[model samples]
Target: MNSADGAAVVVGVDGSEPATRAVLLAAREAVRRNRPLRVVHGFIWPLLGVPVAAPAGAPPHAGLRHQAEQLVADAVNAAQAQESGLRITGEIIDGEAAAVLIGESPTAALIVLGDRGLGGFASLVIGSVALQVTAYAECPVLVARGTARDTGPVVAGVDGSALSRAAVEFAAEAASCRGAPLRVVYARPGGRAAQAGEEERLLAESVAGIAERWPDVPITREAVHARPVAALTEASRDAQLVVVGRQGRGELSGLLLGSVSQGILHRSACPVAVVRTPG
Candidate 1:
């Protein structure tokens, strides 16, 4: 979402199919925010014990660094070509991909990353780097896939946590910008009986409550009894944007995201925005 005074956007590029989508999204956001953009590529030679720099006559490190550099250049070029006056900088950092991205996220208004990547185990976790970055980035992180980048309503997960309140605010602003309805989700479980008497809050009430706190915008809510991550993902599968707060609640160790946020990052069909506000 574009902050009123504009904000910088940072994106992680690793020459993956999903990365192109992230770059495009980040560029668009940068333009909208009217702020600087950075196309970051974190590099570390594969563990094959292979050289990474060019030999005397051979290509540098068998062209590893060269290829990666070219890839980053192309990504940055593509992103910058679309928007004039965009301060798009490309950074080639060495070390673990996820770690560096997290390192740079401190000053970033938001960190943009792909839903998945080329390397690492697949099917469940998306990829290690993407997963780790979303979980620990200093600023809010938006994880996008190529397909989900095009656009939808700004959907946010609300769990009554203070963090979720921040997410709702962010989602409301995004939905307003896109002129889309806001979807608020709270999940518990189904097919179970509770106490004899209860004054349950309607799912829609949550969304309505948040909407009432902000500027007028269409709002919707859902309360289902299922896994928080599962329900949120399934409900927002067709949504354009889904925002959730990082679960790093009280008394946590140095830098940690909640399990639900981490789980949704890997499984949500739509691009997920994990918002983390400083304590």
Candidate 2:
């Protein structure tokens, strides 16, 4: 199913620091979109058949279920603190983290996640749940990472594909919400002058519709003569968010996410949103 109109912004929390950060970011997005915020925590103990209830003499709140409930409560509280007026709800689902979030995606306005979680490997830039959800979620997935800057342009990477066009649309809306400028970036390897002109044309076409839709949103274009990942990552250094398509041009059609988008998710110095264009 696709995300319906007026869907909520759903965020999965594991009580990890990264998850906590995601809650704040999600709350902000919920306020910006004027949508409700749904905080979810995946409860695996019940699914694993582990006795979730407390021992015979223990208190009800001492059970695994209680702990899961408490986690969701905490996340909800955090989101509320971020924005008092935001409508918030919490849920504890019996499933894996990634699966639960993916299940929520079809009806979510957006899915917000953290770069890493408690289960994250120190060597890995992003957690398994974050990567998995980003690749499979039906809606845009925003991985809150690096510095959550309050001031910076909304950067979007385009490859002149339908998916990239979706990214531009999403980015334009984000920029308008923040009253920030939208920077459209196109990265190509060759530095040939002839290619520069083509790259400029592609960037212009990518933002044409979005620019018209968000006329109040100032738009700028950048043609980078570098690898897609490197160029976007560099552009993200001072950006509030870097938006990219689930898959880009020249990528294998079978791949759920393009290499450029994946790389930005890992290396971006700001939040990254991967837009999965709807059919």
lDDT of 2 by residue, 167-196 (tens): 999999999989999999988887556543
Candidate 1 scores a C-alpha RMSD against the true structure in Å of 3.7
lDDT of 2 at 53: 85
Against the reference, the lDDT scores of all candidates come to 0.75, 0.89
Clashing pairs in 2: none
Which residue pairs come into collision in candidate 1?
Answer: 52-61, 53-60, 53-61, 54-59, 54-60, 54-61, 152-240, 189-225, 190-225
What are the TM-scores, per candidate, against the unseen true structure?
0.82, 0.94
Best by lDDT: 2
Model 1, residue 128: what's the lDDT? 75
Worst 10 residues of 1 by lDDT: 197-206
Model 2 per-residue lDDT at 81: 82
TM-score for model 1?
Answer: 0.82
- Model 1, runs deviating above 4 Å: 1-7, 45-52, 59-62, 149-151, 192-216, 249-255
